[model samples]
Target: MPTEINFDGIVGPSHNFAGLSPGNLAATQNAGTTSWPRHAALEGIAKMRANLALGLTQGILLPHDRPNRRWLASLSTDYASAPPLLRAQAMSASAMWAANAATVSPGTDTADGRCHFTPANLLTMPHRSHEAHETARQLAIAFADPAHFAHHAPIPAPFGDEGAANHMRLARSHGEPGIELFVYGKSGGAFPARQSRVASAAVARAHGLDPARTLFLAQSPDAIAAGAFHNDVVAVANEQVLFVHEHALADRDAAYAEIRQAAPWVEIVEVPADAVSLADAVSSYLFNAQLVTPPDGVMTLIVPVEAAGHPRVAAWLETMLAGNGPIRRVETVDVRQSMANGGGPACLRLRVVADPKTIDPRFLVDAAKLDSIAAVVSEHWPETIVPDQIVGTSPDLALVQTVSSARAALLRVLALEGVLD
Candidate 1:
């Protein structure tokens, strides 16, 4: 006989708010209909944020350093699928004429902490007039054709459209050469993948993953708008997997339960409805701050965050850790403040990429000190220059130096005459 199951229990939701739906909040009864989407989005985002944090603490292998690189890799089919601002900038930049040719342009690498990962994108040819055509030619030559950079995967082609959106994450799966991806059809614009279903197959073949192991998850098969899936995938250890599922606008318990039961070894955790504050739909700070495990307990993240729901999120995470070696959160210098000034620690950093071990988290943090900066500039400035006066004059290194030197000379002349302030 099989051994009797002796399950301890999970700290997650018990009933899982089985009956509550975010859509049920009455607009007329609550605040107003205008705020419904905001509230609903926030509630859902809370759970999603929690999922990201949990996954991170669990060591889901997220790229800590090059966040943009990883984010962009998640897109391939069409840049237009991206948000308006992003799409606009991307299109606008590639409009240069010279960008059509295939030639490597100079680009700053990772050592400087700016943008090192996009080396192949160095060929920047700007265009005028026939902008779109020039961009296409340049991008093709620059990257050896769009298809070459198309995640190098084989996916099903949608009928008539001949394109499918395929998303890929590069990493080793612990067991079974299998992977699962979540893709949602985008509405309006052009989702070539929607008509072709090509991206799915493209993604599978590109990664050389087992066909059986690759599971494609997409919601709203018939919807015109691309939607975020309620499904948040987890990278599992062995034969077991767990996913916390909930529905929006509708009681998706049946659909969720079905998916849950399909994997006997997989446990389905339900989340409580009250987890999010209605004041906002979802909080990004809460999710990013959640401590997911380090895959091998090998990775340590040193994030410099400023006012990102860090306090409340950190407190909640600490309680959940169960004292298991406990996570350590190091708050480095405020990068946001730096970025607002058109620079960041990442921008100032010069990293030694030899061992990855050479990356001392303190290097950037140490460099952020105001006194250290003042000292570095002090040696470079003339003896007559005053650091405080230079700052008051301007932050421009050249301008500040010139003004300081002039002021310092006046001070020296006055001092020689016994005149002082």
Candidate 2:
């Protein structure tokens, strides 16, 4: 009964474009632009609906409390007294990218026979560093069934960990024991390399994964310099397929060799840089696509509309599909809002391989549940959010009230008001 369930983060009402991430090109390019929270949330729900329609299990994680009062207080300043930069950091809805929430090792790969989760201590970014507390709390709630799950607190810092964004898993199937790939970054030109090698090792140990079945590889400096902030941005793995850009790893040959040794069934589908330049790959977020296997046993690539529109990416995908490639079909969804903030479809989801029944039911959803969540989003989420409105010399009390009420309305409808407590 074990399966891969994608737990997506509901786009929060305070979603905005402050360009807080230094290495994320899209977020920087779109900074100061207006954001549509309602539209973003609806697009996300629509994505979940698409996956649900594909016969895959789907679940969701609620948005974290924004203008994180606790984080602000830790910095010795309240929202009203915080500077513009501080205010911007506190109000970030970056948590909407659930992939950064935790690093998961399914029961099949753990020593104790229970799925293991380690909440990431995103210490590299000021805007994201405060997320672990809320992320950990929510992970505890969703995976509270101790019989099948074990949740660990964030990895202690000085060790920056970005969770599943820098991790990948390959198995014969979701229910089988498989190899775990952990990609760490050494240097990234002007951008901070977020995942520390030490942090990844700690997570592997915490999850009790077999050393022989685990691989710790360095992310390509070229890819990171070109704005592939996380490994998922340049490569994504599902089951036996490793769909990646040629320059995604520091040494593709060594990485591939190790991967093949660990998981011989892995299909390395590398897109040559000549065919699709790294710039094109990152901008189009081509590799950020979610490569999922549906019920029909055919593997499908769920990509952002950006990838579908990019000339090189589209052409490459067309050729790949035409051939007898492992990825047989392509499905594009509009996540322009999340993309603008440097997250594509893969970034919006956290993949947990487990039985649907083992997860908290409140987090699971069907078409009807999605419709209800969409209704709440449409009725309450902000139509638009301008950066200046949330991060000026003094907080815009009206905008704050609007975002607060919007989330409250959603919780009430989902009957998850307990999340706030």
Candidate 3:
């Protein structure tokens, strides 16, 4: 039986919200939310400090507990609409979100939960299977399949770019079955066109799959190597979809043709300028923790809700209601306050596998308490990485987790006004 996606957690850093997405910055300066874990600039130096202090393998930014609902609705609607995967979403309390997610079904998973969908990793995410599996293991402990106790959720600790096989190995060693690994032949990041190919090769070598069985590199029309950001590809209810770059130097045509051979039932297309390609967008959503729901559903989209004008939001609202998707059931609200607190709709929420006996779809209800969110969009990113030319990458987790402090303060003020909840 094939494993399919039911839902997925969107991931990505929201620049419109967090002023402090750690990127390539210098170390001589003081570190704050926006300047935490950047790339190679003052990187290793800063990481040394974090490693000693908090086991900082990588500087991941997080939202302050409460999420933006407006953004989530937008995201959910985007997912469930026509063209499918590139437009899916989930629900949040009072905001909305949107992403290039294709589906929620996993093509394969180890007994532990290490999963594999397709080349979305090759195109977008440099390393995502390892990340999500880690999330399941370290944070949620959800992938503890008994048979593969040691290999459950093959999450890489010192995560190196080993490619899909390494990721699959980690997942499978922990208990997943054999996954098809896409092989690429390069290694660099500046030219995203080669990202898919390079990532595919790197992942295969990492997993050390049999070179014979592995479909070695056969350059796509234009060097399409990487998959979408964060390895976010899904197949839902037999429907499949994923985002691809419309014009990234990579061969969009080859990608469509080849990925289909294995992911035979997927919906692949070019990324939209108005939005990141559905594949890349998945990582973007994950970076921010956005969801996929519908229009009428209240959501808290956390990113630059204000960056795109109300009309854009309005346009977004309209675009969300396309087919038999979920957008029709949502309502949108722009909650900038939550963005100010470092998380938009997606950041604060996570998608976990359900434990039938105790599942609660309202995963975020308790986390959204008035005083639960309290950080503000970091007001200090441009100062950190501009020196290096690595334009857009957020700093660290401390910048955007939960905003307990601010929420508490709000409660106090509300209490003083005799309107506390």
Candidate 4:
């Protein structure tokens, strides 16, 4: 039996709207709005509980410390001396999107018969670049059994790495070896291309994946320019099914050919361009849906509430679900707080296929842990955070103290007080 665990990042106290991501449409459109850290954290916890209720193995990834002292020290500046954007980036809670947490190769695919993880360098954006180190540390601790898990550092940069956001796997069964698809973007008009061919190849080699079982596909430049910054924005796969947009890749036919050759049993479901334009797809985040095979063994789509509001997307979804197919149902989740910051259901997690007994107990989720986390968020997290509090001539000292206090409270709840330190 294959145990697939979903590890979701706990929303940090510094969750705010700073419009730091260039190619992310939501972050740009909702630039300076007041963010509710309390609501965001609670909403995320609720999502985890919902997944657990479905009989899925759920885990938690602790948030990275904000006002990162290492980052500031590297720049040779304090908060006051640092640039406004730099300060905001250092305090970013963007790590909440755990999809970019790391690139995972299950034991079934590796030569050593041990799972491999390479933390994403995330060098595309200043806010995300600092996440790799902390992500590696957290993964190492959570997956401490070297006999079962092998943790590797992020790939060297110049070749940007965005982790599993640009990677997907397909197999006949979770226990069997799967074909790993790595999507790289050739050009990004405003935002830099986050994943490179070199980086993808490096990770595959590091994981000891067979070359014949790996496929490298280039992302459509048009999609990247239109704010489909990461490949996850336009494509997702689960088990033997791949759900994607028509314009997701530069060479669709070639990519499909490669996929079919490697995994002939795979099913490809392509959404027509006429039905949902690239713009609509990016805005609605239709492809960012979570494709999960629950206890019933039927695949379900867990999408954001925003998808139901998009006319074309909703119609297409209804039509698709009306028929008998791999995707048996459509479920909507309210992650508005995360959606406003350019993350959705899929972005909130990193999927790992491993035995439950092999994982660290601290990262596992249960009803008691969920209740305790909810309580901590409601009581300690800030109700709202305005842009002025973190950005501008003089930052608010009180806001800083509040954010720090909230993180401490969370650490205490998880019994991980000194983990990050």
lDDT of 4 by residue, 276-362 (tens): 999989989899988898888978888898898999999999989987668888888889999999998999999999998988888
lDDT accuracy of residue 185 in candidate 4: 87
Candidate 2, residue 233: how far the Cα is off, in Å: 0.7
In terms of lDDT, model 4 sits at 0.91
- The ten-residue window of minimal lDDT in model 1 covers 6-15
Model 4 backbone overlap count: 0
lDDT of 2 at 230: 97
Per-candidate clashes, comma-separated: 45, 0, 142, 0
TM-score (all chains, Cα) for each model? 0.32, 0.99, 0.37, 0.98
Q: Mark the regions of model 2 whose C-alpha exceeds 4 Å error after superposition.
A: none
TM for candidate 4 is: 0.98
The residue-by-residue lDDT of candidate 1 on 215-246, one tens digit each, is 44443332211221111111111123221213
The parts of candidate 4 lying over 4 Å away from their true place are none
Our tally of clashes for model 1 stands at 45
Q: lDDT winner between 2 and 4, please give it.
A: 2
Best by lDDT: 2
- lDDT string, candidate 3, 1-421, tens digits: 2221112121122222222212111111222233221121122122223222321111121211122323334445321231211111111111111111111112133222332222222123321221232132222222233322222222133322222221111121111233343433232243232224444544444434445334433322222222221221211111233322343323446645655565454444333446533333322221232223212222222223332344443354345445333223222223333333233333222222223223222222121221221111122112222211111232232322322333334335323212211
The runs of at least 3 residues in candidate 1 whose Cα sits more than 4 Å from the true structure, single-residue gaps closed, are 1-178, 185-198, 205-208, 219-271, 277-282, 288-319, 322-421
